[model samples]
Target: MALDKKTIRLLILEDSQNEAERLVSLFRNAGRATRVHRVTSAEDLEASLGQIWDLLITAPSSAALDPTQAVSAIRRHAKDIPVIRLIEGNDSDAITEALALGAQDAVPQGEDERLVLIADRELANLEERRARRAAEVALREAEKRCQLLLDSSVDAIAYVHDGMHIYANRTYLELFGYDDVEELEGMPMIDLIASCDQVNFKEFLKNYQHQEGSAELVCGGVRADGGNFKARMHFSPAAYDGEPCIQVVIRTESDSAGLEEKLREISSQDLVTGLYNRNRFLEMLEPAVERAVNAGQEASLAYIRIDRFAGLQAELGLADADLLLSDLAQLLRARFGAQQPLARFADDVFTALLPGSPTAGAEGELRALLKQAEAHLFDIGGRTVQLTLSIGLAGLDEKTARAQDVIDRAHRCADEAGDGNALKRYDPADELAAAANRGSVVAMVRQALERNGFRLLFQPIISLRGDTYEHYEVLLRLLNPQGEEVPPTEFLAAAKEAGLAAKIDRWVLLNSIKLLAEHRTKGHNTRLFIHLSSASVQDPGLLPWLSVALKAARLPSDSLVLQLSEPDAIAYLKQAKVLAQGLEELHCKLAISQFGCALNPFSTLKHLNAGFVKVDGSYTQDLGRPENQEALKTLLASLHSQAILTIVPFVESASVLATLWQAGVNYIQGHYLQGPSQSMDYDFSPDE
Candidate 1:
């Protein structure tokens, strides 16, 4: 036999010296990575326990010397290190038992790879487990930090889903007149939603949550005893207690607007440059367009797209990238005064609006910066990097007409054309199609309103039991100038996206009210309803304008019902709630235009004292389908039980009308009765 080394730290736990010396040879010849120690007896094991053993062996004669206990104690001291138990072929059972008991592996009288594989795999598993534990601990710490921040935030915060309150801040409790968070924990925020908004509050929240991860949900709420006020709310879903859930924060509208202005945090502020954020800047665009047109002043927008940004990101991690952006924002702020609004549009992109500044001068300055920036090196993590830019320009010429339009054109030019910091102006012919579209849309709308180019139709809403015409719904028609009629379904979306919904709503409301008031004065006992859009609700100026207009028309508030779309209102809930409240204070009867959009919490029904719920057309329009009819029946029954009037819209035929009547509909409106009219003089004569 071959002995590898003259001497080593070998005191094998064996009863025989011959077998112990043979096993010791393996360690002496073991690879440079190994440092092993061994003991040969139970007493020897105890004595060697004080020694740091990287590897241990059981000699053949020590089979009965409590090999299990000896190996177990060795494992406690060197959990990561391997132990090779020497075994004979006839002792497989004892070897298996010893290996299971804590010995890393059993190597037969000869050398084998199995022992090495076992040792390597076990060591790797131990390391992975340690890493996972560390990661889990870090995640826990992060979650705790987020929770602490949320709890102490000034905004009233909460989480609501499926009409259930899952989380809340103390500020939320105080806002709603609750004494403790515990009291409000399981209560729906809608429970305190003002009486005038109860009918659609849940619908609004559902809609708002679906708008951009989170939107500012503004609405009116009643204090514990019922005093009403407006609130600005934010709700976004985040993981809580390992479950995906919503997190909400609310600031009263007055306090929110005031606080925002004081903090100079307008909706979305470019945090780095401290300028109006992209969202607010976009909002300011339309006004800027109008201002330019009114003042006959020229304006241009330079959509600056960062080139080679991803390369920079790859070269410098996020922290260094952020620092680089901060530096760039500082340069922009210094170059463009605070009055010239600027924003960090995206991670690497920035935009600046130039007013009264010549396009050529702006071009010259940007060109100079581009040259400097291209050659300028960023030192990050001992690495140097450079960035380039691409610019697309749009001016207040025939090419780009509105703020969003200008932004899109500029972005298209920058993105589609060029390499580093190349400057290009918008091409009129390039955007002629879009311009033509705008002109066509505006002309179509003007024609609809001017030539009485639209139709006005009414659907009589009969009492459920009485089956008498108690009210009528005023519908719209978009038509060409030649009296060729256009369907509302065809143009409502275009009207909305084109930002003409509010004007259209105003026109419809004033006309509907005038007609309804006429019938009321003639002792006809008629009430007419018209729909309002979310855009109109967003405009706080609308309510007072409506009040003044209606008063001027001498229309009694109750005689003219105002219809509001559930989905639209829900998206702009806070605004919707406030607008509804204003209408209620004016004694205007309000109805949800599309109810049962989603499963709204019944708790939301406590506000709005809503007189009517227009069953969503999907549920009522196709009573021909059993599912549609059944859904309508269930909805009508549920609504009627709450003493809420149910109106079925889009009744195209008498058969559909009769089915709705049997299903307990409180009113009916649609094409089979009358198409929309162009003027308030539309007469819903029984004979017609």
Candidate 2:
């Protein structure tokens, strides 16, 4: 089952509402949507424990409730909630005490970054525990169902371990002329065989255990009533109660025909919607992938997910949700046709394979299906509910190596398109961009660092409100052997993987500072936004190194605005926060580029003292859409209300100038304004 990635349910033990809000802001800023419940009393903590919570954060100095009491309450209720204690200052004694009393970890009260990091780790561990619990429950239920099926089978079947009978169905007991399975439970299989055939049967069983496939033997059998009969027994490797065993199926001449076919169909089918199950779909996919790779045949696979099905399930309940799912399965089967290989891959996801079809054709079919799903309303127990579909299509060709990889790619694309009722086709270019063949790139990065073969370019961030001060974002490129500049997107990832990201970041900072110091000597009040990778953000030695570098260049810290991408900032929130604090101490500024893409962009700003935020370029590129325009306007309004200076990038044309200006944007940067050049020569004067 997929864990909910959108929201985290938190229980905070604190006396002050302000402090509680501060804690919530930490998670929010880290791109986590949180539903927080703050409790200051033991009664409140006990009541809250009745419900599920992801993590429990308690203040050791709370006046109304002690941390010990909160931990006690959780233990009494047998809750699995992880506890994090907020201690005063850097009290090592208090941290040790809290852990001894059942807390997972303890953080200093003012160290909000540490708290956020600890909370993130605990929440991840909680998710894994929950998933394991769900798996255990499902396994138990499956075992029960398998037992029921085995007991109800007509063929005589029994399971044996080390030649002793462990289990036998009713038919097997009746065939042996025993009234109860208990009577024959401990009997050896050789004892059941007639004396004359015992030696032959022993040799056959020994050989069967040493082989990989099934084996059969026709031997004389002795019943409990001293009667004899000849029967054919099939032996296959099996497991019982988590132990290796052998499964024996005995068939007399009078047994029914077509039993094997019926069992095969039952094993491959899903009892819920009557479609093929995930295992069966995989069985079919493997052969299809082989045909595509070996025979040059073309095929396309699509992963379909029901949008907001979790919310739908919560509203309609599990029973009605299953009914709705059945209705959806029927609709999918009809649309894809009976010959297509389709399966309910997960609770709210489906997979389909179209043989001899290209991605474009498959995408068209999926779009039509999406439209149909959007139009049709599903009725479950007289309640009508409308839903939309998010489909991801991936083509199978000689490039496809593994069936599982294709499924994963399509699944990722579906998740990317989940926000809207849309379809996304898997693009191999994205994979190629982040490919693992980074040996050459790593070598290039190291050589450039050693020889100073790196170059920096600057693009002017033109102010919409006509501010006099000049601003430019620093861009990095590597000079290859042929003097061609290679973009960071091509090699930065490789450098990061090679543990050289921090070195590269430091090199850029040192050179950029030197250039900025020289430029300032020309009487221009300019500031540069230099981007940092996640590795640099997490580096403990970076701040000290940066301080020394800034002083060596004799540049004002404020003139250098360090920037981080939204994803990197969110991923390393704790480190980013610490870095931001350190930069503030040095009078440097922090800016989050590619911002406004998270679930809560402003939440992150609340935790960090960010002076500038560059909105994601998609907002500017998609300005042609009215909804996108309004979205950008609203996002800017939120940022502006917080007193944040907004920089809108990718201003390719003048058409968006009026909209951006009306939205109170502070700066705009793109090719239309001024592309990145070797020299920072753009004029920042007002258009008089």
Candidate 3:
């Protein structure tokens, strides 16, 4: 073994100058440049051992200069350095005794390679120790800085580990009626919350353990005097003293200052429920909408209504009904806390702004909460009443530019789902078509199909990693008799209802392939993404038809990708599996769009062989919010882990590009890149 040009510090115990010179020559030949210090007597060896050295080489000598005695003396000064014993011959007994005395290794004389290898190994180990020691020192300094910040901070902050307080800032000590942090340390976190909220706080922690980002909740805080005050607490995961902990920030109702500011806050608050009034909610929503547009992330508005609320108000007096609403508001606040903004949109109707489109867990929790509320009987001045809730959720997207429009859509959806008291998502196409005459819409779709009035538009999907192939999603638009383009949502439902989806899919496929071939001839390598309706998933002849179409156009089968929505794929799982396999056989790829919406999305993935997954639009549209960003990062990680290329759709803003790149998404498509166009043209230059 030859060492690289690293200079070794060698301390040798030898009586002969010739032997020392020979050892140094061996090391130099092995590429180890060394500074050799030859010491013979015990006093010289002890004095030389004071300096730092990499290795100690002891050549076998007479009784006056014993290698074992030198090894013992070196250990007394610095036990960490490796000691190599040089034996003149094969003396196994002496090697064993030398090792027992602290020799790191034994090498035969003239074996320069063995000595060099031992020295290199000892040097590497020492470097590792130094690095670990430096890291420990840095951690200690970080902890001290954290402590200093805590001591100087005016805001009440505390840290808890294993549900017990481990540390508290000065402001926290003052607010909790304690003199020192030591007094607050080791106290149970529940003890700080009032008796009524203790149970809820415990439950919150259980759910929060799985939550990715920081969360806030309003609870009753108790002071040393046993007085309770409403307080908002924020919990963020943190590390302290090299152990995991939760940092808590507490703000009380009395923390606000100045009468004028307080009055202004009250002006925006609903007196009956203490939630944000309609005007305030609308004001807040304007910025939220702007943020969503600029951040290219999804934010959602929820409209909730009480079923038969008018009858309940009639049965109970107006005052009593108002009391019931107030009680309901309190319940909402208790359950959701400050996770998102809540407002009283109208009489008996509430609206909530979810910054990040609610997760599947959030959706389920709300559904369960609604069920619990429905089953609970309310007592209003001796009168008993039961109410069900209808909730409608509408996510902010490129089309939903106006806050008022989103709120209106959500309200309309909730009213439409009133009979079933269901939770419905706002579907733009469905909302628009509901206002049109159904017979006229059906006739219009049929006429447009017959006239071949449908036009294909392509939207480029940009690749973050600079892939050479060009990709675009083929969108369809139906031109009416007046030459007006009908929104896909409006015409798609009518077509599906009239059993025209299969024909429509065929239309889209044929046009996309024709366009792809023409674009390829112009020297553009392009692939088009086309949607497959549920009807097409069951069309056994679709694959054969595609084979003929590809052969006719002389287009590569892989140029066209078939996309199936998660809901449609799940609704026709067996057929979807067959279609996926068939598409594979045809050398085409299958992509599952609107994925991660199912109760068990990965379960559906297990049944199908999909090459790509487009994460649901709701999750990607709100990348501006910190919580949403974290959620998207986690989802992208899962998709990448499974070796499935992820394509995040609805990339409507430039701000989201960096985040998407960081997440390692394969492709991105949205209005910001370019709306669907008649020509398959998008600037693919790296400069852009």
Candidate 4:
């Protein structure tokens, strides 16, 4: 009797096609949908091995090929595929020799049931190997991404294990007067603190680990040159290199004239405009520049000059001009907000500092704001007065090492922009040329959302254990103005920063459910896996909206499995818990994808009702290695103990399938089965 039914490809090496057909008939009778290709000569056998096949069977005493030579060829070219040798007359010595020559198992002629059973076992082994290699690739990619984020952090951050520094960002090295990470290697955490606070700091560390949350301390910091400065350090329990560590963030307090000037301006406020005075804006600019430089971020400075301020004042009089200026200031505040520093620099000039990486969208938005101001007619003292603005935008980059340099550059650009053009951007490298590139990518994203310019792609999630339900993961793609397809990785971050991620998520959710409804009408029990963003986790409206959409589509909740990345779930734990609980109430399943990379991934699951956990693909990319195999087995064992179904993704080759089966993975997915397609056309029926 057949133990399982699966579609498997087979390669046979035999002189007689009849004999190869008989061997293939055994697998077919055992309930496997077998795709068999017979190769009699050595050349044909080599060609057959080059293609995809699940198992290889060789016939001994053939006229065209030697069984030993065939095994040798398979071992050299396609070693991952299991090879079986068929001997005649129950020759024990021949079976022993074949087994020693790397054949997985040797069986006598006939006895079709035993042959089928051996093939089934070998196929399972092949599946496990393929799963493990996929995992290793995912892990390396995750590590690379983590390193990039750590390097780009704005604060001086470090990870300390056993009271010694294990890892530090670029900002941390610069703050402690170290040129390279090697200089701080094995350095004690206490050494960074001033001698005066050493005793108190030691006491704090002793009790730090036992505390529930993060702890902050204000202490004097000692630099490598022995200089001391006031510093505030925050300590939290984190993990580094697969071990527990303390994450530290240090911020040094400035004691320069700029700081004192900023303090003086904080007490006095501009009554009319509700903005900072000139000194305050310039003071904040210095710190913004420092952060942008150290963190590899860009700080944008905008210099706005009222076009022909003297003429406006003369025509409208002092009282009217003052009202107009105050009204304009109110408008600017309404538009830019007070997140960064906004200040009235002079009688008619205003300035604002934009912190973070400068995007093309910021420049385009500023210009658009300028255009709006030009188009608006102000009602001042019962009379209509029109005003225009000459705006200059300067972004912090390698050339502008000093904060004051960028400020001067913006002023020069504004001065050069005259009244005709009225807008200019300081781009020494011509990198932000408006004519060369379209307006902001964020603007493009908004337009796409408004026009419904998004498309969906589906990738099959095959069942390793012969589950009947058809599964596919839904992926999103955006079409740009040029009709070019923009991948999610390229535009998804921009959408999130622009606060449009929730809208995108809803679009995918509704569309996927609608498609699922249509797919079910075809008599196929199909399920779609959809991804959610961090913004979706916090959106209170999403769950209710999803309930309505599902009801309208007449689709069951279980047909859709909403998933979020593991890092995102950890970042927004409270919101994730709510989403998970709400999904449970809705009778929907939650999948935490890209899992097992956190400090303690299981800790995350303890708070949520995630029924499926997709193991991070990095663990399986190199499953042939013994270490990865052991790690995957351990994770699977832990997950299975909790009765949670494990999904091993990125299964690219047959080599890792056997290892995955051994590790007890319930499901598998990757490009090896199929890349994403417009239709869910994967052959789910094993009988096919």
Higher-scoring candidate on TM-score, 1 or 2? 2
lDDT tens digits, residue span 1-688, model 1: 1222322233356666665555545444454233444454566665554433334556443564766666655543322334557676635444544544556666665554554445445445544544454454445445556876776566777777666787776567667777777776677777878777777777877776566576666778887867778877677767666676777777764444344343453247766556667776765565556544343355677777778787777767787887778766776677677667788777767887887554544677767667766777776557776677788876643112346667887888787657756777665444533443444655587545533455567666655455333576777876554456556665777788878888788778756665666666766767777788777878888877677666656666677777777776667777767877888899987788778876673434555567788877778655789887887798789888989888887777878866777887877667676554443343444542
Q: How many backbone clashes does candidate 4 have?
A: 39
**Model 2 regions more than 4 Å off:** 1-439
Better of 2 and 3 by TM-score: 2
* Model 4 vs. true fold: TM: 0.40
The residue-level lDDT of candidate 1 at 407 comes to 87
Give the whole-model CA lDDT for all candidates, comma-separated.
Answer: 0.65, 0.83, 0.78, 0.79
Consecutive 10-residue window with the lowest summed lDDT within model 4: 428-437
Q: Report the number of the highest-lDDT candidate.
A: 2
lDDT accuracy of residue 597 in candidate 4: 97
User: Which candidate leads the pack in TM-score?
Assistant: 4
The estimated TM-scores of all candidates read 0.36, 0.39, 0.37, 0.40
lDDT of 3 by residue, 1-688 (tens): 3336667878887777898888888878877788888876888876665455667788877444688778767544323467788877755545544554567777777777777777778777755654454454445445556776776565688889878999897678767788877877799989989999999999998888778789999999899889888889999999877788899998765544333453453478898898999978876787676555444345778888988888888988799989899988887887665867899989989988877663222466668768878887887788787778898777764234567778887888787787556887765446434544334666677555544567888899888878888999888887665667777898899889989899899878876777788889998888888999999999998998788778767898998889999999999999999999989999999999999878889899888999889999998867889999898888889888989989998988899999889888999989988988998889787874
The superposed Cα distance between candidate 4 and the true structure at residue 660, in angstroms, equals 1.4
